[model samples]
Target: MKYFVTVQATQADYEAMEGTESPGPPRWSREELLAMVNFMGELNNELAASGELLDAQGFTAPAEARFVTASPGTEPVITDRPYAAADVQPAGYWLLECVDLDRVTEIAARITQCPTPPGSPEHPVVIRPIGEAPAP
Candidate 1:
């Protein structure tokens, strides 16, 4: 089966990207961010070499986000990001082909261990199986 693993951050966490307390810049140090990126790259490389990584990517900040409601008769309400009211949003995702959900969950758990801001608690990684195309 193929699974999508999503990394999520709460609004608070997203806000912290620019600073938590009265701040001027991101809280994470350059070295810290670099290390995390390197670790992630290594993991991705490992998965790719094993041919299990179908796709993976990190998303831009919500500041660039735009939401459109597609409900009928509801004038397409469009909202740009800096979504201060959002409870949670995806930060990154990985598509993996695996034999079982257990393995997928284990991978998600490991990904959650990637270093986050200092003093930050464990964030979340959502995993779900992708729908397969019907056999013709």
Candidate 2:
């Protein structure tokens, strides 16, 4: 089965990370961020070694959107749409092909334990198995 792991952060957490001056806390130091990246890469390498990694990547933030409403007789109104008014936002994701759900969960757990950069807050990594398609 294939799985997708999504990482999300709260707004406060995101803000706290924004001005980090070093990897430890003041700001995310280059080394700290690199360490995190290295850890992720190591995880990918381990998955590959186990013949489970299919594909993975860190994603850029999504574009902003506005919700608009229009009346039958009036122009539409526009309003910014927030994700549940939560401070957290999705930061990255990973995709993996595993033999079973247990394997996927294990990998996600390992990732959760990896260290985060100073400015970067630890976000929950969501793991969900991908659905299989019906035969054509």
Candidate 3:
């Protein structure tokens, strides 16, 4: 089965990773950021070698996101802002083909262990199975 796994982070977290000064969370050092990049690279390589990684991508800041809504017989309302306020937003995702839910869950567990600042709050990792369309 194919699964979509999401990793979330707060705006402060993103800023910290970029070596920017934020209000609350401490900023990350150059070495710390490099460590995270290396970890992700290793993980991606491992998954690709195992033939489980279907696709993976990281998104830009939430401020760059756009939301759209429409009503009947009306033009769509498109805005560059988020539709709802959120403390945590999806920072990246991985689409993986796994043997079962257990396998996917294990992968997500590993993601939760990714390197981060000491005492950083743990963000939830969402994993959902992809549904298949009926045969055409």
Identify the leading candidate in terms of lDDT: 3
Q: Against the hidden reference, what TM-scores do the models get?
A: 0.81, 0.66, 0.91
Point to the candidate with the largest TM-score.
3
Candidate 1 C-alpha lDDT tens digits along 44-115: 998899888999998877666788886887778898746663456788899999889998888887897787
Please write out the lDDT profile of model 2 over residues 76-104, one tens digit for every residue: 99987665324566666777888888888
Q: Model 2 misses residue 52 by how many Å?
A: 1.0
Worst 10 residues of 3 by lDDT: 79-88
Off by over 4 Å in 2: 10-26, 62-86, 117-121
Ranking by TM-score: 3, 1, 2
Q: Per-residue error at 111 for model 3, in Å?
A: 0.8
Write candidate 3's Cα lDDT for 64-95 as tens digits.
Answer: 78899999999999998742323689989999
